[model samples]
Target: MVTRDDFTEERIKKLEKNLLKVRKENRVKEIANKMHEVLSGKIISVDMNPCYLNDLSYMIKKNLELVREALKKNVSDEGSTSNVP
Candidate 1:
């Protein structure tokens, strides 16, 4: 019972949904890349500043906590996607 226009519309909707999913994945990758750069810079600073060792440890602990949370969220996202059929 689907007309030509209905089929085209459905195709367009699916394409748009796929595009949105790709964009979201790309954005997540970009954020992770930026986080890596920031973490590297922090490590370099810590290496250069012995006096800031305590601060570096604190920062590292906080960053690790954030990374753990992010990883958990990522795992959940992957799990949900895997369940899709």
Candidate 2:
């Protein structure tokens, strides 16, 4: 009972859905790359010094906060394109 036009329409719909999926995947990869770039750094020496420990802890917390903000911004930017859960 399927006509040629119907078949073509179905194919087009499938392709559009696939394109959207690919776009969403690309967006995720972009976000991940940005996060990696933000977090990448030289390895620091570890010692028993309390000051060093405090500085390391602060750096980690700051990096995590930056990542969170970046993710939030990305999610908001893509709000119309995809649903972020």
Candidate 3:
């Protein structure tokens, strides 16, 4: 014994699920684009002084890791907010 309301509710839920999937994909795409830009625009020189090169290389790696983590946290936060009661 199903009513029109039941069908509508199911459809809404399915659409919401699909929307969330799309949002997550878009976020990943945006992060990848930003990462590509950062790598392309900020080139490191191989002939740089050894002392400075090592330190700078470590810093750049750390910064990129931080950026990736921040982006992940942002996506998680957005998803959580959407589920608020």
Candidate 4:
């Protein structure tokens, strides 16, 4: 079960802000909804340490890149054609 203690208030607030933006604009809302529906999402798992904010920049950058890649893939039809299996 997920609890409030499991997430930071700042993180929750940021999610709320994103949701607000999603609700406010048609294009953004559509894209946000699509990203949520598709295999594109952020994974912000904070550390238990109280002073871990300084270490979050790398994680934030990684997640941002994922979001960007997802956007590019979503906007284009020229996708991967084969699996390297």
TM-score of each prediction? 0.51, 0.48, 0.48, 0.30
The regions of model 4 sitting more than 4 angstroms off are 1-51, 78-85
Q: If both were scored by TM-score, which would come out higher, candidate 1 or candidate 4? A: 1
From the highest TM-score down, the ranking of the candidates is 1, 3, 2, 4
lDDT of 4 by residue, 1-85 (tens): 6567766776889999998887657644444443444335555345534333333444455668998999998767446554457
Write model 2 residue lDDT over 1-85, tens digit each, in one string.
9999999999999999999999978865654554455458634445546754564466567778998999999888888575556
TM-score of 2: 0.48
Residue 21, candidate 3: alpha-carbon lDDT = 100
Off by over 4 Å in 1: 42-63, 66-85
Off by over 4 Å in 3: 42-85
lDDT of 1 by residue, 1-85 (tens): 9999999999999999999999978865655554566666733443445544444455557779998999999999888876657
**Per-model C-alpha lDDT, please?**
0.72, 0.71, 0.73, 0.59
RMSD of 1: 15.0
Ranking of predictions according to lDDT: 3, 1, 2, 4
Q: Give Cα distance to truth, residue 73, candidate 1, Å.
A: 18
- By TM-score, who's the top model here? 1
Model 2 lDDT at residue 8:
100
